[model samples]
Target: MTVQPIIFFPDQRLKQICAPVIEFDNALRTLTVDLLDTLRAAPGIGITAPHIGINQRVVLLDLPQSNMPEIYINPEITWLSDNKKQNEEGSISMPGISAPVERSVTIRFCYTDLYGKEHTEEADGLRSICLQHEIDQLNGIFWIQRLSALRRTRLLTRYKNI
Candidate 1:
């Protein structure tokens, strides 16, 4: 698996809504591997296909506490808890910046695996937050957008200066 180059924030491709993955084939498997490698190299907890300029619905997430990375293809949030939690969120595309973003404390999501099997899973805490963040990327929502407008502006300016 190759560690692909990350397309940083403000790139037009990052704003393009990703297309669903239709073919569960070797290419898809390769993309998954590449994403995992890229995320690991990014030293990040999560990443999405569009971050690397692949406009397909895919995400890789591996919290440091997890046994292994998770690859989600065409992942969609199915349910969200009424309760909310705030967690600091960063991005592989927009490195070195983070802010607390409010999200559901728990979520249920459906996704396809590399083998084409559909799976639904429930998550909470960091897993829940990371999944939501990655899915947002697949939907053309940058993580910074999750922040308050004032925070988003300040962070982007800081990112630009970096």
Candidate 2:
């Protein structure tokens, strides 16, 4: 597996709504492994295929303290909790910028495995946050978009100067 280069913020590909994974082929499998390697190398807990300019609805997450990475292909959130939580969020695309983004404290989502098997599961805490974050990326939503206008401006300014 290769460590793919992450696309930076302001890249048009990062803003695209990724297409669903239709064929579970060797290329898709390779992309999944490459995504995991790239995310680990970036030292981020979560990532999406769009982060590397691939317009596919795929997400990978390795929550803190977890030994194995979780792969979600063509994932969709089916349910979301009323409760909300604020977690510090960052993106590999937009390094040196992070903010507390409010999101559902729990979520239920369905996804396909590399072998084309489907699974549904619920998540809470950091796992919940990571899933929501990565899913948003699959939907063309950037983490910075979760911030208030003022906060977003400040962060972008700071990141620009860095």
Candidate 3:
């Protein structure tokens, strides 16, 4: 397992649409390990393949290390709760910043595991937020995109100066 470098926000690779997982084999096993190591070293809860400059539909997420980390491969959201909550969300890409953003309190998703087995799971709390946040990466989006126009503008300006 290797700790991959995370590409910060404003990096062009972050915006690229990722490729789907194919040829699930030993290569994938290594990729998953690298992703997990990278996320842990990021000391972050989640990471998308593109963040490491690999345009593939994969992500790694672990909440504070207490919770077992989850790996999602070609993952898709299946359902969500109407209930929403705002939390102070941060990302390695953003460096030293975080902002409150609204997210669904519950979500259901499906994905193929490294062994090529399909699985579906429901998540809530930080897991919910993590899934939504990570799923957004599949579509080339960041949580900041969900912020209000005023807040988005302000954040952009703040980061620009940073």
Best model number under lDDT:
2
Question: lDDT at 125 for candidate 2?
Answer: 89
Off by over 4 Å in 2: none
What lDDT tens digits, residue by residue, belong to model 3 across residues 70-157?
A: 7889998999999999988878788777899899899999988978889999989988898888788778887788889999999989
TM-score of 3: 0.93
Error of 2 at 39 (Å): 1.1
Give the distance in Å from residue 30's predicted Cα in candidate 1 to where it truly belongs.
0.9
Please give the clash total of every predicted structure, in order: 0, 0, 0
Please list the residue runs of candidate 1 whose C-alpha ends up more than 4 Å from where it truly belongs after superposition.
none
CA-lDDT, candidates in order: 0.90, 0.91, 0.84
Over the stretch 41-120, how does candidate 1's per-residue lDDT look in tens digits? 98888988898888999988888888988889899999999999888888888788888999999999999998889999
Error of 1 at 104 (Å): 0.6
Candidate closer to the true structure by lDDT (higher is better), 1 or 2? 2
lDDT of 3 at 1: 76
Candidate 1, residue 136: Cα displacement in angstroms equals: 0.5
Ranking by lDDT: 2, 1, 3
